[model samples]
Target: MINRDLIEVFSDIAREKNVERSELATILEELFLYVIEKEYGDSSNCSCIVNLDKGEIEIYSEKTIVKEVDDYKVEITLEEAIGKEPDAEGDLDVGDVFVEVIDPRIFGRRLVTTAKQFFAQRLRDIERNYIYEDYINRVGEIVIGAVHQIQGGNVFINIDKTELRMPRNEQILAERYRRGDTIRAVIKSVEFTSKGPDIVISRSDNHFLYKLFEMEVPEIEDGIIDITAIARHPGSRAKIIVKSNDRRIDPVGACVGMRGSRIQAIVRELNNEKIDIINSSEQAEILVSRALSPAKPVQLFIDDDKNYCIALFEDENLDAAIGKNGMNVNLASKVTE
Candidate 1:
């Protein structure tokens, strides 16, 4: 209480850490209890009361009043109980526990050292839970973050309240980030560790493309179109299949929009990456035909037993069908398989 700066210091920590002022109170209480344990040998019945307004912390050790003391830590003679509390002489029974106020300052240097240890660990634990609670339900969501730092060839991004890791593997090959640059990614996983939640985000994930379309296209948002499958090359090109519940609606047309306005927004978000929109079909051959786009296969033979298909097209369509590096066929095979 003598150091009024304690209140200001706590205020600054709460503000900077993005946690409630009350959370610091909880930490202070635990720190005081830790000090108590160091000074008193046992603190099972010990409790700490922290008044953050005055920057004051008090420790109380409670023990049951008994006729005879078997364990001095847990049991106190009625005389000793009455000595601590004057009214205990008549009002309290042998089994009734008495609260004894212990001076937290008595621990002195040990208190300061122990308090630091407890505060560091407790703060980390609380922060981990805090991070986990913040992003648990946000998994599979696309969030915007600023590049915080690049460590060991991996990117760490600063989101709304905290930072998250975006490993090299999750990054788009063509995408680059500088400090403070804004980037968007899908929340792939949130792992809670002893220190904090290890949030893994990705821009290369196929789900990122799916979410971008859902955000840009009203038909997809309204449930008129369902994106069934996506095959992506991350910052290069991707093929997607969509289907409509309504017979009158053309899923591909609806997704592309008039003048290509709708799909263009998604492309821009992906840094002008190419996207192929195809209609989904129930028939395997029809689906495979649509999957292999910009190339018209003249004839196709399906062998369900072998789980393979023979797709024959005019020799002129060979280069286009296989794509520049067989990416078209590769993506088609992924969709069909």
Candidate 2:
């Protein structure tokens, strides 16, 4: 007879976040029957029911009751069926001939052990899927993780209780992180594959700076200031364009903080990367000149299509206009557009 206490398995899963024991139970039963059929065993006629209350489980061999019982292979005589169930009639349901608690020992010690192994494997698969979906939904946001281990070409990070591969290509060139270090990065993607979901992270993304500005500047966070664009060289320098929704608020001053402390904290994490916050305006001439700040441009000229800008500076100021490795011009172009 099927035990009613098996409902407890579903109850525990309901309390937990992701475990669905009802679905797992169905898979376990299917796997057990498949293995039994392959071994050409009599277990093909057996069924199982879980008893959660007593923490016990049982298996039984089932047979249909027949009038004459001509075919013993698929049917049992009414006389034998009635003895198994006193209330059984000729038209009794198939439940009447089911043997109660068939000694699991009859299947041999090895057969009983196989069922346990199949159940464990299915449970592990369900847990992995639970963790995978949790991470996938938080894509494009910054998250902190622990460095689990350094594989040959990639570092494995433990985030949301799952190991994710951080390859060398995704890591910043000058940044070197060791095991046990807590690091943060933006989630680039959550790709689902045959094995599982793969979460990709990036430390050098331009969006990282935009997010940092949102955190450091109260004006931006509260919607008084808006970040139009940002460009980063990662561990070296970055440029951000900002505008204020309110007439009185100064977007640049708010982000810089008193004595340059706010932006400085972000600079330290990026290995002293310099940040230049510029004003964003609709006027091409005004915006272009402001974009190239820290380098005064006396004469700023734009092309016919206004795609590129040319600046004329004194001989002494030309070097300042284009900083080391042309970083100043590169950042200016990115922010201006």
Candidate 3:
């Protein structure tokens, strides 16, 4: 009855945590062995088998029959051995192997409590591993989650029963997140920590913008358009260079969508941050000029050896080219590079 109740409780928790049945069995076996070792001082001769389907756990201890027991963990006296199995009295002799079935109840209430704690911790570890493995493969992909916690300018988002962290640096400065607010970001990185997996998500990353474009534009996802480079000041402005594999499709127009619907959606998601999509070019001058949109340079002189360009812009366009805090020219340089 104890075994049934224990198995039922643990099975429910494991299933809730999405732990595999096989993994739960392994954890159960390990838990029993741990308890056995703690009680007997040694579990080397002990084996635990778990049948989750039957809700049964069997523990066995292998010991050698001896005339006198010195180490009770591995040796049992013949008198004691026969006492356990009277039918085999004639066959049982000194040095013969005795198999003893252990009742888990014998471990007492104290040990059972300890076992529960151990099982809970094991489930937590398994949950951490599952979160790590799932998110590690999803780096650079966008995830939408609800804000669950806020501490020290860090946001904790809950999605699919897992919590993701967005640190202050990864969050958009202009955005304000509140509890229960739905937020979207890209999986920036996954790191293993002693407490658990530290799943760091980001909204300020350049890849966030790239992924937004990918989500909004089917041509980009379909391989019709390739985003060549991205430079972002996050919450402010971003520039992306795109190349069209199919000559018939206009990469910029496809990304813009009909009546600016696609780009508008992305802009709204990003808190109205401006985005400039430039067509990629093999020629450095053409690419740089396109990168500096809304402020065309009068002339551009490229120095291939120095890997630099000198742009001559009209006085009226100089302020626009440089942008607020020189962000425009810096992004242009980054995208062109």
Candidate 4:
């Protein structure tokens, strides 16, 4: 009688833990073999037979045929071998190996339970490793998830394989998350904790803008144009510096799309935040001038030693240069940095 109940229990565990059934069976097999070795002494020539249909287990021990038995667990004399095998003397030699059947019940209930616990712990380790590897490579990439819970002012989201906490500091002030609402965030980092690997996700991160723009514009995805730098005020405004590898392609126009269609999509995703797509330049003055867009800079004073530059603009365009609450200049400084 195969223990259908035992198999079913394992099936339930596999489903709950997101593990493969075959992998669970392999872990159990290795656990049993280890238990058998601990109970019996030497297992260099040991084998386990699992009969799931019969709900039976059999362990066999192999002992070497030797002229003199130095270790009783691994070796047997010719006379002893012959006693176990009637015609062993005619077909066996002193250096040969033979199998002996051993009772599986000898391991006892306590040992079997201990082995099961060991198997469970190993399963947890495998699960942790799988999660770590899954999220580590996704750092700085965007993922779509649904809000699962709100606790202590922190939002928890459910993504593909695990839950991520959007720290209160990493969230946008204008954004509100409710249960079942789908949201997009960038994976800022992955940290290993005592419990498991913890993934830190963010909606305010600069990479969030890069990822959204890439999704909205095909030129960026095709490598014709690429984001060289990004700065975000999150929920308010952002600036992205782009460069085209091919001279024929206009980086700014490509990102802005035809009549602002592509940029509108990105704006909708970002809650209507203002975005300034600037062309990247290798020269410091041109880069600073481009970083302060909409309001053209009249002059740029670069101080390489102090690592700062002063941007001069007319009084009429001062508000455009500084933006609301100095947001534009702040984002420009971040972009230049």
Q: State each model's CA lDDT, in order.
A: 0.84, 0.73, 0.91, 0.83
| Model 3: residue 116 alpha-carbon error in angstroms | 2.1
Per-residue lDDT over 60-116 for candidate 2, one digit per residue giving the tens place of the 0 to 100 score:
556766666665544776677667668645556543464534544455666546655
Candidate 4 contains a number of clashing pairs equal to: 1
Q: Which candidate has the top score in lDDT?
A: 3
Residue pairs with clashing backbones, model 4: 2-53
All candidates: TM-score: 0.83, 0.77, 0.92, 0.74
Candidate 1 global lDDT: 0.84
Instruction: Residues 1-337, candidate 3: write the lDDT tens digits.
Output: 2458888888898888888999999999999899998887889999999998888999999999988888888999999988999999999989999999888888889667988899999999998998889889998999999999999889999998788999999988999899999999999999989989889999999889988888989888888899999999988999999999999999999999999999999999999999999999998988989999889999999999999999999999999999999999999999888
**Which candidate would rank higher by TM-score, 1 or 2?**
1
Span of ten consecutive residues with least summed lDDT in model 4: 1-10
lDDT of 1 by residue, 221-309 (tens): 89989998899887788999899988999998888989999999889988888999989988998999989898989999999999898
Clashing residue pairs in candidate 1 are none
**How badly does each model clash, as a count of residue pairs?**
0, 0, 0, 1
RMSD vs true structure, all candidates: 3.6, 4.9, 2.1, 4.8
Q: On a 0 to 100 scale, what is the lDDT of residue 309 in model 3?
A: 96
> How far out, in Å, is residue 118 in model 1?
3.4
